[model samples]
Target: MSAALDQPAAVRLSLADALRSARETRALLVGPGVLGETGRLFREQFPGRRAVVVADPETRTVAADAVAAALAAAGIGTEPMYLFPGAGLYAEFGYVTRLEASLCRHDAIPVAVGSGTINDLAKLAAHRTGREGYLCVATAASMDGYTAFGASITHEGAKQTFNCPAPRAVVADLDVIRRAPDWLTAAGYADLSAKLTAGADWILADALGAEPIEPRAWAIVQGGLRAALADPAGARAGRIEAIGPLVEGLMLGGFAMQWTKSSRPASGAEHQFSHLWDMEHHVHGGEAPSHGFKVGVATLAVTRFYEAVLACDFERLDVAAAVAAWPAPETEEAAVRRMFAGTDFIATAVTETRAKHPAPAELSAQLERLRRDWPALRRRLQAQLLPAAEIERRLALAGAPTAPEAIGIPPARLRSAFRRAYHIRRRFTVLDLAVRTGQLERLLDAAFGAAPASTAP
Candidate 1:
């Protein structure tokens, strides 16, 4: 099958429809120069509200300043909040704590004025401070966290994603967004592409009885994906025509996760790969890859793994023998520690693995179910997943990285990461499925070109 390279952008996403789906996100103001009306919207929507406008040093000029000025023009009180300027700023525990303090001190609603990090810090701080939601004025079409219902924060030196509320509203000014770095726009497209594999993973879990797919949540994201990503070249060129759809697609991803109260609709193994790198922090010469960039590459990797699995010969399996060979809980735990040794986030890996590792009997049952349903499961995965090469083609067209090497993840680390990626989350993923089928090492060998014994579960 050929890629849908020339399809027109889909129109399934609308601000009103998306807001209705997410219930928590009251409004989404998107268009040219929407930031100029942020104060009026804030006052009208959140009557008598004073805002603590949040931004990092970089966005303080273009985004935060406009929000503050607009609020001032509308005679609404504003206390601007700025993170200390540095490359070190991230959505981690320390930043969340500091932002929460600012919210408490100012006694104002958080009006975020940046992309991923700033938005995550603001939303999580609002939740920690007991607010149901906050607002965001997007400076760039970077990641899909603007209206997402959680925060990826590093706590206890581990990348821990905590449940939080979605943004009360999102304001994206197309004029300002068009001026953002082309890479950020391309990253937005790259991020939304993960939904293809994410939905496939959800379908696999649902098919095998590990988890049920949420249809409403799935529709919110999966429906318009094709149209949203119809023009990778346009996105690469930073054209508003293409970038606009990308933003709409990303917002829908957030709403899907919000409706389900889980990341299953927008994350799976691809996200685990990105999160693993965040915790490890050794890529790109110790400069962490952008969430979207890493996910794009990992999405391709996992998609390839899925394609092979979907086509594998299930008749070759000896279910009873495989069950007998399943790794012990203690062995998996030891492996987790060994794989993540010297890493700050090893605790998270250990915690999730211990909590999620199935007992031998349980594994046998799941494997039995999987074997019974292999044909149906295979059909569902094949239907849901796009070709890995199509994704690679799209990312390359958008000037995004399509491999581990492109993101500074050496071949050895890629192998190690794939071996342990499933341990980072207490949720089922393709990695878990592959391990269950006793084909994980084979799949990894295909991706990494070696049957490393260390990858065995």
Candidate 2:
């Protein structure tokens, strides 16, 4: 019965720190072979609750027996593990419904023995299906959803995030993660790298007096992002020293989302690209790309957009004419439908586009704001970007897809995705900036021209 995070020298996001700093998540136990005692850990964190283990066929092999055995050792009451059907499960509404149906009242607290998909199901089932808080035994250094409050699930042919709490506690066994797919580790590297650009978008939102970024949450995640992403090769290699921070850093991103109650701190325009792909699915040959890999390429695209923006002299731009020329709602609606054609995502696209499309009055106000604050905003945006070359170098080292082509997205689709992405969420990203200022076409040219070479490992 050891507490993994208690070891000072061996820990990155210590259990004490997780308990203290994370807004909703209670405890964290991350160490070599720590998952062997998941049952005891669960009992300590959520005593008197009937523990129900949930896993898929593959995840069960990872830790089901160990958790069941540990619960037995702890003399805690438990039900057999509820095995979900999956070769690999997609987080969609249907699957969430199935998970909800699988549970019973006897399952008071859930212990999810997997990564993104399983953890998302667990948290959603807890919130949406009337179960109390749950815990996670992470199996990979994959996406950051484990500690995040929002579940990114595909619903009605669209990728939508549902608000939920982070896992009550999280346990990551280094031994288990070292055995995970190399692509998963690489995806984690790519996902963590989105923070710099995401922060910049948040700053833009703040400037517009739209959705302002929270300073406290911003510092916690961004403060450690560089160290987290610095050793991408080591992380991909699954070295304990290198991989440990990768895990902690991803967890911190989740915590930031929880503090903000929104994924803005960790997701920006890059995530919208992933959502666009999820919306069509057929465009990617009906195979979903890893969220992290997609975002990595998208981050490179968005970083380039910021570069284009910073290079331009806003003083020369005709703000008055641009505001006058801002597309009417119906005009953009037609464009949205046209771009998202051959997919069910068209309806949602139209809805979000119209909702976020600025009216002339609002457009005029925003133009005045942008014109007045252009220089200061440009400086902040530039300060937040990592050199585009550096971003690609790190992604290449980690064996992640560096471009849309690497993830099975063609140039036409990627360009279309860029245009349609701002409509996916109302967030004011560089995409919105370009669109509002009549520079979207120029930004699109740069994104596609300097695309990162595919570097899949």
Candidate 3:
């Protein structure tokens, strides 16, 4: 692929260049008709091991027969770990247990044959069993959690990210993706857009000495996100041509975490919002929406937040006082229950420690340092961040939800999500900044509107 094709080309090929420079992978291939050769790939990659194909029941019915025929023709044994129907099913503990049992029963090496949840289950199971895992990506929608070094799954009914390795190689058969629901493809594009704001948040963290910048990996996320958002059809049909870059970009996003040993590069305010929504789904007894769908809405909110910041005279930003009045224990606990739905003792302890010592003064000094370095920081972001307009435009083209209302979330929920979201994860993100500064309510009001505006798309 062209270097510029990996990220937003208008922003320069910096992200693409970075990814090319940092990648340590077997390979990633996306083509219109690559599914038929699955058996060959398994044989070449693992000469003697049995191949276990893990997928959801719907996908199994749609694609399993073809895969099985190929395996049988190649004289390779195939095992299917059919998941429950629908999103978030792959992460449920029962599903994990069943898959584990299947793997143990067959002594199988897994090949996840579906997108999202199926991939996560195989990766996590492989990690636990120390078996090699591979993925045949079924869609080009959004770029995240694909080639990453972890599995974001639900354990005991709560979301958690567990350590794992990227697939041996990611094979995206674009033909399969074209047949997926348009919403899935759009969700993928939205997930890729989050990279713009996510990259900015990482830059801020690095500037504050909280995180380190890996230019090469950052470049992957930057380029991949930019490129995916730039394609007009990426917002629409989620075509094969678009899939190549989107898949490449998302794979690189996950790989960047491998390089950084952290998720700082691809997570920011948008992610927190998605996490809040994910928990709410679990709490209210509903299927969790696709990660990209929630993230698309959150990305727009962050973009609007940054835009507002750009318009403001932040010179008068009350950094110290903002941090001083940070949440107390009762408030923190309440926020956690509301946003995260539940909290374990470790999270509670961390909240209490931070609550007792609101480091606003220390953080305030850091902001001054950031202000002094804003010029360089701005340059870095300019090279990577997507403008809010472009992000919304791309999402609209993909026919994905670009606002809270599109996802059945109430306008009040958006505001509440912002206030309580920081407690969902101990990580410091844009939401933390908004809450500390007491600007969250205003920010949400601006992004989603005063009323839910049920018209949000």
Specify the highest-lDDT model's number.
Answer: 1
Alpha-carbon shift of residue 26 in model 2 (angstroms): 1.6
lDDT of 3 at 341: 43
Q: Could you tell which candidate, 1 or 2, scores higher by lDDT? A: 1
* lDDT tens per residue, model 1, 1-457: 0122112122244557666878578788888878899988888777887888888778887778878889899988877565545578877788888877777776688888888888888888888998656788988888898888778777876666788888888899988887788788778878988888887887777766788877667667877888777889887777888888888889888888778877788988888888878777645865667888998988888888887787776645677887887788888788888878887778888999888777878888888778776776676667677788788899889878987898898766777677678888888888888787777877776655775465444
The count of backbone overlaps in candidate 3 is 12
Using all chains and alpha carbons, the TM-scores for the candidates as numbered come to 0.88, 0.88, 0.81
Better of 1 and 3 by lDDT: 1
Instruction: Report the CA-based lDDT of candidate 1 relative to the real structure.
Output: 0.79
Q: Find the number of clashing residue pairs for candidate 2.
A: 0
The 0-to-1 C-alpha lDDT of every candidate, in the order given, reads 0.79, 0.78, 0.65
* Model 3 lDDT, residue 340, Cα: 39
Which residues of candidate 3, in runs, are more than 4 Å off? 1-25, 72-75, 79-90, 134-143, 232-235, 282-285, 316-361, 375-383, 435-457
TM-score of predicted structure 3 = 0.81
| lDDT per residue as tens, model 2, 310-341 | 88777667878998788888888887787667
